[model samples]
Target: MNGVITPADTLGTRLTGLRGFYRAGYRSVLAYRADLLFGVIGFVIQTVLAVAVWRVLYDGHDEVAGVASSTAVAYAVLAGCIQSVVMPWQFSSLPQRVFRGQIGVDMMRPRSLISQNLAQAAGTMVGRLPIGVAGLAVGLALGGVQAPRSLLDLFASAVSILLGIANIMTINLLVSMIAFWTLETGGVMILYRFASAFLSGALIPLWFMPEWLQPIIGRLPFQAQIYAPLSIWFGTRHGGELIGTLALQLGWVLALFVLLQLVWRRAVHRVVVLGG
Candidate 1:
């Protein structure tokens, strides 16, 4: 009886292991102070530019397509800062680890690779939170960001944003799994970035898209990443519409997580390292 591991013990052990990985990831961000400094600076610049661009676009126009200029600028700034933290352009080192035969070490660990990866990714996101906050501050100072419509909307936006981050992480892990077969994901990652940036509304909200293209993008899972949360933040989709958006975002997160697990299983079996 003393030796038997209870369910609670197992859960606790897994959580502990995930916490260690998360810390490692967070520390990795701090390992390079210069890089972090420059990265934050660049993010601020990007956020300022986005704010400027939106302001210029909305110049002399109070409202365009049912969205006020202030709302549009606010959305652009918030969306840009969010994207800077969440949808980083680089594919994770998972692909490289697989290519270099280092994935075996990760696979041999007691914890599942997916959990470790997700924990690390979450830690990295948290570590970079300051950058987003700084950029958001700049936007707010410049009158480019607007407060949430209300406390309820703010709460809903928070939940939606969490779900959106989960959605993006799962999708990223799924794409990284491609390295199991191809061993190189540069071109694929570039395509993924462009598709995600545009389809996810990181560049421009779906409201600005052509009517013909709106339906197609809306049907895809990308909209759940950035658009849903920001839409809630800006109160563009309220009442039943907000509820529906959150439902769809939650559905995508759950669906993508399942799909990621399935892909990871297949990818594990396909892993073959020669002469390493």
Candidate 2:
């Protein structure tokens, strides 16, 4: 009995522990219900403003940069919802935890620091699910959003959205880990937000960008976050294109995972030597 492990004692135990972390993360967000409400309101307002601006810009034009007015509006609305799920602020406390001498306590936990941070982020996203749903509903009611053209489109869009969340989380974790090298990560955070928003199509669909810029943006992981998902939902990407986009997202997730592992190892070493 001491040497042999049953199924329940291995996989089951790990699952239970992960679930506990998730629930804790979920409750943490719920503890700030007022902030959640305000966040939803602000997102809705931004979506509405974007829709209005795009509609006016496309008033007499059939298409702008190969994208129809309807498609652009749909992209804008859905992009807003997707952005809500990929929140970077969920892990903003990592640097603070490091600075406040709490990392030592966290390191003592049985679970890996990355796993705990990920569980918290996942829980935060789950807690913010209502906000995303509300934003989608408002988008649909506003009469600009288009339904998924086909079943494949819907499925691919869903998959891309999930992958996008994972990609965003890994990126945030990588950024937070920079705290290990430098205590001041404000500049890094600010730059990441600006670059991600612009490059990810949260601010503008990549399709509308200049032809020269398209190729450059396509190579970045940012487009896979909001642009690819919205593009699928709007029925712009079909068959091979849809599959390729998802594959790209998968690649980014894998790459970022490896990066996180390498960075985390070095970070732990630094913490140990510094006695913080």
Q: Return the top candidate by lDDT.
A: 1
Worst 10 residues of 2 by lDDT: 85-94
List all candidate RMSDs to the true structure. Answer: 1.8, 1.8
**Local accuracy of candidate 1 as per-residue lDDT tens digits, 149-233:** 8999999999999899999889988898898888769999999999899999998899999999998888789998898899889
What lDDT does the true structure give each of the candidates? 0.86, 0.85
Q: Write model 2 residue lDDT over 126-170, tens digit each, in one string.
A: 888888888888888899789898898888889998898889888
TM-score of each: 0.94, 0.94
The TM-score between candidate 1 and the true structure equals 0.94
Which ten contiguous residues of candidate 1 have the minimum total lDDT?
267-276
Stretches off by above 4 angstroms in model 2 are: 1-3, 6-9, 88-90
